[model samples]
Target chain A: MAAGKRGNVYVVVGMAGAGKTSFLERVATYLERSGKPPYIINLDPAAMRLPYDANIDIRDTVDYKSVMSEYCLGPNGAILTSANLFATRFDKVVSICDLRAQDYEYFFIDTPGQIEIFTWSASGIMITDMLSAHFRTTILFILDTPQCQNPQIFMSNMLQAVSVLYRSRLAVILVFNKIDVASHAPLVKLLSDMSLFQSELEGVSDFSSTLTQSLHLILQEFYEHLKIVGVSAATGSGVEEVISVLEDVGAG
Target chain B: MNVFLSLRSTTNHGTVLSPRRAFAPTFSMPYAQLVVGPAGSGKSTYCHNVHQHCASLGRTLSVINLDPAADEFRYPVTADVRELISLEDVMEEEELGPNGALMFCMEYLEDNMDDWLAEQLEGYMEDDMVIFDCPGQLELYSHHSAFKSMTEKMTGWGWKMVCVYILDAQFISDGTKFIAGCLQAQSAMLHLALPHVNILSKVDMLQDKSVLEPYLCPDHQRLANELDERMDPKYRKLNHAIASVMEDFALISFAPLDISDEESLQFVLYQCDCAIGYGEDADVRTSRDVEYGDEPDMSNLSLE
Candidate 1:
């Protein structure tokens, strides 16, 4: 698309209500500040509202409501079906991105609310393959900062993040969202300090807590491979650090 | 839950459950609802709304928190699966993914239904309706046999079980999303093999409410026309194939829900009752209620 200047593709995925769309806008804001504005693609056909403008919107290509009624599918199934349908023509989407690849430094794509729907589905693979064909693709896995306080729940959510990391084998950037509401500093501390995690697990001898202890060990290695960023999409804080991390990735 | 194993619990259990002995035909039963949907589809909200609606109807419905992953609930839980086996415990004990751990939690519930759940359930009266606010994991209803087995167990315990599949109203305001919701409900119904009711939750959030009216009942013709309009001509076959299923299955109809509106909430309750024959046995209960009516007036005729 350009002489060594093609854009990077960012596939943003997360659990429902983890604020993926809002976070994408913040990333775009950070990218746009340096005049390398992102070319966005909104892959969630069922999303009711999006904060950012997308160069390619799935809603424009496939109407999820029509797919829902026509396919006699539920919201989950219709989203999947519409995704599959849109995925069939994803080569076209990639071609369009290639056409605009010169103007943008980043190609940001926001996935559906259901993380599994994007990460664990056939359509997810199709979309990823298309992006990786021309662009260096990375997954930004978002986690709700307020929701992951409990060691057990945190482990479960971490396992979820680890899933896409393992499945796609793409470089994953863990975005700890909603930091303005709940700071992730304690969580970052727990991940790094064993004694701190032990203290967090104090007074709990259940299987989950004990397993979370074991998982903390395994996650130590995983943490080595992945990158973590704490961002408040609401207040637009930490957006620069996220861009700096991506820039480092580009450099590496 | 271990609470059911206590001596105080066992003693009080008979007082509540014993009344069912006279009413159980061994087949007919008061209804218990199983709330299901994917994550963030408002299953919890629906459970909260239904609990309030039943409370207004002079019915004390027990809301059961079946999601081991759920941390908070709006209702006062009478029984909870989190007490028996939680995702936290499963994830700790078994090296499983979130979906796997959640599945383990549900299967664990199903395995203990006869003992743990039965004990907890027996403490409530036969007419104390139960609403199971299940996990958002779709596999539990799509293919997993745990819920199906639980349904069988509840049926054997003289409780009619129905699956309430909640879908976000915003998603279904359009055509493609409407089909997805139907297929999801159908998959759940097929797997659970229980009477199912589909709910379009959070209808008030939809910008143009009129867009959803067609999908509530889902007329085949209107849906196909809408599909044709929205989808590309090249994919007409795919669109028609999906629309045809809606016509044939007749299993995908949804009832719109506006949680804040009393009438709307009650309407959904009415649909659920019709699906499960809830209080259809009212004639029997009412007839029994009128027993002492003209008998004491025997001074006029019965004594002769």
Candidate 2:
């Protein structure tokens, strides 16, 4: 497939088990069938198994098992060590992507499952910087939908989303995942109707009622303009809507 | 002639070979102490509790009060940043209100890292542990560069710190809420990039542990299904992705800690200990000098 004139790169990021890989697989299938499959790169070092074929895999370059065996590390240590190693040799990863240059419509980087490796580590930042330098990357933030049903959890997730936006400096597309099993009405109601959470927001802190109120008001202002889509990767429901949004962003 | 030549060569030739020995393991204490969590998550309380716990154990630990708006603490502090940058002062001087002032205080602290934090931590021993009672602001751990910069500076000072993230157990009862808590915990973990331990604090406050039991030892697939069942149908796809990611990555399980329970506290502490490789240097000793007497006669064992 020839590269689309838009030439967009989307990075799907979330905590481990956030369904990033599954979504990528489905998206790849969808795009492949549509004759525009994305160039997918798997960056997780500690992944013992995966469901999809990665165009580029970090494991091939850095042997996580050898690092564990040679260094006497547990799983987390090995993952961190492998991430550090990738950071040291990220140029090779860039070259791998470059090899597939203009071969696909988009480059979808499947990040490390550990959120910390992508968000907090210097290596994560370096990867983002390198990707941004090469292509216009937008972050597809997959949020657990059930977690957002409650006001407090929603607030915390919002904080995390904001954090990632600031840290990665990528245009964020927030996707509430796992909606097939949960009551999306309450969350959709919460996001759609901001007035319902006024008292709840006020109740979080006494010192910042005015501050909180103003912040809430500001959030509502932005919320009205924001595009939030809920989807189920398992059933393929709402996947098209998500793709449309991605396409729009890519075009933009 | 060949025998004479071999004997002469053997007598004149010599080889020097050095045998290789196994390298000894090296251990060094952490240089930094990181207290992290959301606002009102009992970060300060945990710091104080840890201080008291260390004292009771006859261990020397110092507390650094990093919260500029902090009014009181249960532990004695060796150094405080309020003296350097007060939230009230930031608000009054810069005309910024509470949130802005808190950010200002953090930025101010960041600006003076060398003079303020370095000076405070200067006299401490290499192995000395300090508890940094941080502010309650969520952004400090989320996106701000101030905390990251501080961590870098601490690491530069030879501190091998672990970010102790405390979430209230009472709040994390349901699968959905637990997932949310895990994301926040994950955020802090990601933002800090240091060794991290996710603690479900205030376990003592829960009258019944049944609600939190599953979350303590979370099954990702089960939680994902529960989460899907609870969310609105419109977000089913989103819920699935969230569940799948969680199930796929195993990103968000927590070690529950009831500070009031010694065993719970000890378990959490043990996790932290392993994170920093704490007891790696201790000498191993075996006791084999005990002698036991055969006791077939009348029992002489005294009940004291």
Regions of model 2 farther than 4 Å from truth: A1-252, B1-29, B282-304
- Pick the DockQ winner: 2
> lDDT tens string, model 1, B5-41?
3323434544334444433443344578899886667
Give the lowest summed-lDDT range of ten residues in model 1 chain A: A203-212
Query: What lDDT score goes with residue A38 in model 1?
Result: 88
TM-score, prediction 1: 0.53
Residues A75-94 of candidate 2 have per-residue lDDT tens digits of: 44456678778878877767
DockQ, prediction 1? 0.03
- On TM-score, the leading prediction is 1
Error at B142, model 2, angstroms: 0.6
lDDT of the structure predicted as candidate 1: 0.71
Q: State TM-scores per candidate.
A: 0.53, 0.50
RMSD of each: 17.7, 24.0
Specify the poorest-scoring 10-residue window by lDDT in model 1 chain B: B295-304
Candidate 1 runs further than 4 Å off: A1-252, B1-27, B123-126, B283-304
Q: After superposition, how far is residue A105 of candidate 1 from its true place, in Å?
A: 18
